[model samples]
Target: MDKGIAKMAFLHLSPPSSSSSFLLNSSIDSIYPKRLFHLSSNQHNRDASLQLPSYSSNQGSRIPAQWRIGVSFFVPFLDRSSEIESLKQQLLDAIAPLDRGADATPEDQQLVDQIASKLEAKNKVKEPLKSNLLNGKWELLYTTSMSVIQSERPKILRPNGKIYQAINLDTLRAQNIETWPFFNQATANLVPLNQRRVAVKFDSFKIAGVIPIKARGSGRGQLEITYLDEELRISRGNQGNLFIVGMVDPFYRVPV
Candidate 1:
């Protein structure tokens, strides 16, 4: 277990120093332990191929703005290789504190041994989650699945330097989205986000019926995509401008 702890220890100490770094430098403060138990929250009540509403930007009618999009792949959780390294660093860092006598007991060493034994034994039993590429349409930044942290929810940081609640793509469509579309009767069906687990296998995707969204007080607005699918490939252009951009493969991020 010291191996696992050691890896995590270093993972916490250092993090990638870029905007794109989402997982590598996860720290104890950000890391959430895995759990076998599942707790269902809100469920999807609608489909992903819903229609979108339209909104205009606050900028004077002449200037153009574009939407900022991001996507990341997701995989199952596992005892990270970094865990061992993290533990080692943690032990080294703790030496100084230990010298200050944080714990003075004969059982401390025994406790460490027990933790190590448990980590080693459990490491063999754990497996990583699995997912598939977005049919080569979307560029993948990075991906790693996490066990649902009981109190944790995904965070979406906006371009304005403000953070907002992150909604699973499916949930965003199901709850906030409203649209009309023609779905492939043979291929597509509205499935429960919780019930579906098959790896993504789409060869192409389309975004249609996009709604414009703006930071509440920023005096700027970009399109908020609403309905998207194989059919009715329509989306709002900047400032509710409508356009049809279709292709062989479309990049998209679907939250699992």
Candidate 2:
């Protein structure tokens, strides 16, 4: 059961990583195990012999026998999964020095945007609003908004803990939460605007996870999910800000 930040933007060191570059690398490693490349020499020789020339769709040209050196040979180079993981690392490295974009300069933002655009172009979940990948507890990795990070506030008032946003596409609900120092949170309902967009209508807010206040008209806004996968998600807020988060829990649910 959780209630969170319905309309706030995100900022800060966030995920202890590029929200954790180390953790990101580890995740990629887990997805692609070494056993994939553990083909024995004997096995390679057998595979080489067994592979035959593959003809083109028109049957006018033939594929070299060497082109069929088993899936392992092509995994490191052509597997979309591996390619996605590689892009994730590149993105992590780009933001690892930005402090979840709290310290990002104009030039830094541009660089991050370039990389993010590439990921969005190859989004695995084309229609994120309807995919299970959209339902999860996503830890903020980088964002373009300053409000969520509270940079204008005196350091004392700035959140000293992590921020999280969770969603349940099935229920058309969402929440955002802060940890420690301030537990400010909010809850909202999601109205579908398109295949990848939603109009968010905030219903309530809780101060320090205790008090409750009903939402007003200002609580409403739009968000478009541009890119999504098993571990990463990229979103755009109504104000033209960009948000990048890494998935932590797929089964995350909002309290009904």
Leading candidate by lDDT: 2
Candidate 1: regions farther than 4 A off: 1-168, 171-232, 237-240, 247-256
**Candidate 2 lDDT, 1-256, residue by residue in tens:** 0011225333122222112100000012245232112122122111211223444566533545666575336544455655565666667767766656677899999999999998888786878888987886777777777656654556566665666778887788888777767666667788998999877777776666676767766666677888887767888876777888866666778876
Clashes of each: 27, 5
Clashing pairs in 2: 4-176, 4-186, 5-176, 15-19, 17-20
lDDT of 1 by residue, 45-131 (tens): 122222323335553243343322211111111224234334322322322222111231335434433433333333322211111
lDDT of each: 0.20, 0.62
Model 1, 186: alpha-carbon shift in Å?
33
Leading candidate by TM-score: 2
